[model samples]
Target: MDQAPLHVLAGALCDREGRVLLAERPAGKHLAGLWEFPGGKREPGETPLVALARELDEELGIALVEAAPLIRVPWRYHERALLLDAWCVTQWRGAPRSLEGQGLRWCLPMQADPATLAPADRAILQALRLPPHYLITPAEVLPAERDFWFERIGHAIEAGERMLQLRLPLWPRESVREFAASLLPLARAHAAQLLLNADIEGARVLGIGVHLTGAQLATLGERPLPLQQIVGASCHDAAQLAQALRLDVDFATLSPVAATASHPQAQPLGWSNFQELAEAAAMPVYALGGMVPAQLAQAQLAGAQGVAGIRGFWSAS
Candidate 1:
């Protein structure tokens, strides 16, 4: 018989400098010698919040003040499965000290090295660094519509949109490159990231992110870009998602959560199926297709890093 997954609570306690606390596993424990968020397993009959508070108090010798659900990662290690429920703790009392004989340190989430942390903690790091919105441009922007896209994208960046994709299939590569360049100054000033759809060289030359097509993901033997650059893939099923993990891509978009004009023929992976796949993934997953900004909360509840869309997330304001 399959064993039930262990419910483990993890707390990401962030300090005022945006640094998060990490605890290293001591000897003889499972995944020992590795770094992870400070927390522990939930006892039976305990709610998630209560369990997290108890674990933090026991493990870190501090009191939980304010926390919010960041992401829930369902991962399997050999025969053992665990649901790593993570919370972002912004406020707390008492200085955190290692009470369990574990080593502790503080570092910025984005600056942490994935290889140094436990496997599941890498997903949590991505969750901390990524926003709840993944924006993709429309399929085709005509010559006349260029100005409109530029204006809206500029405004979006100014409005705190840090990541977006430039998917202009109808335009020439040079035109797309130029357009991306035009936005670089503004994007840089605001610390926004720009990605091109399946355009590896363009992204490489421009020093931005690359959203891989399924075909490209399958053919690549290893990560095409370095760790600092974002690498996303379009995934539809378990196999594609597995391939994405093999490549160690930063994130993937699992699509068609509902029927839509873009892919009407594509069957929707209703919330149940979407959540199932997402839980099994070791990296952050985004819910795409038939998505709107309003569904952000619902999508996150289903184990998504966020919602991704062309029309759903676009706004000049």
Candidate 2:
């Protein structure tokens, strides 16, 4: 039997420099000594935003001014299930101090070690680190158009595309490896992360990350790479999404939110279905298939981490 999810509102109080405020659970409480985003359980009939505001005032002596939806984390902890509704509190009135006498720290997302955080808060940390747009390379890049594609990629990076996937399935292994090698420096120069699609060996050799196909994700029993390296997956349905979560993938892309020119025959999931699946996902999920940068806000409203696409992103101005 499934129990009703306990809705808890949490806020990532971000400073101007982009550090998030975390509070350590005090002694004699559940998960004591563990760090987590500061908030509390939602009172009946209270909205998540209202509950977050109340919690902040009570726990941190702060007034919530503005906040944006961050991520909704649904976690199962042995016998209990929780729905953590997180928001990025960008504008709050007072400086956050631990009014409850708990330890407080403000740190960059990457600096928030998972070992020191509550198990349920780990996914929120990952969500905070991920960018709002994911770019996927075309399936095949003609040799003659290589320079053109590179220029386009460079331009996109310059415009703040921080995460990318090179998915050249039809290219020779050696060719893909060489091309990825050449692109790594460019990606690094722009402070962007590049993931090799369905090429674990190449990714390992290149000291980069790998993006697993759905088939590869299903076959994996454990994480393929070290924790330091990013691992993402392409998931189409609930089963694949579960597998990616089980492997503890950094993120995953769920596709066909809208009909696509690339895969004309594939049916789109639509926003309603996308929301249903994404709400239950354990990790950050990017909405793919016929996606454009303009749809990012829409995707987020539908419980997605962001939007992902090939042509939509590559061709954007």
Task: List residue ranges in candidate 2 displaced over 4 A.
Answer: none
Among these predictions, the greatest lDDT belongs to 1
Q: After superposition, how far is residue 130 of candidate 2 from its true place, in Å?
A: 1.2
lDDT of 2 at 313: 80
lDDT of 2 at 127: 94
197, model 1: CA deviation in Å?
0.9
lDDT of 2 at 69: 86
lDDT of model 1, residue 143: 59
Tell me the lDDT of model 1 at 316: 29
Q: Per-prediction count of colliding residue pairs? A: 0, 0
Q: Which stretches of candidate 1 lie over 4 Å from their true place?
A: 27-33, 315-317
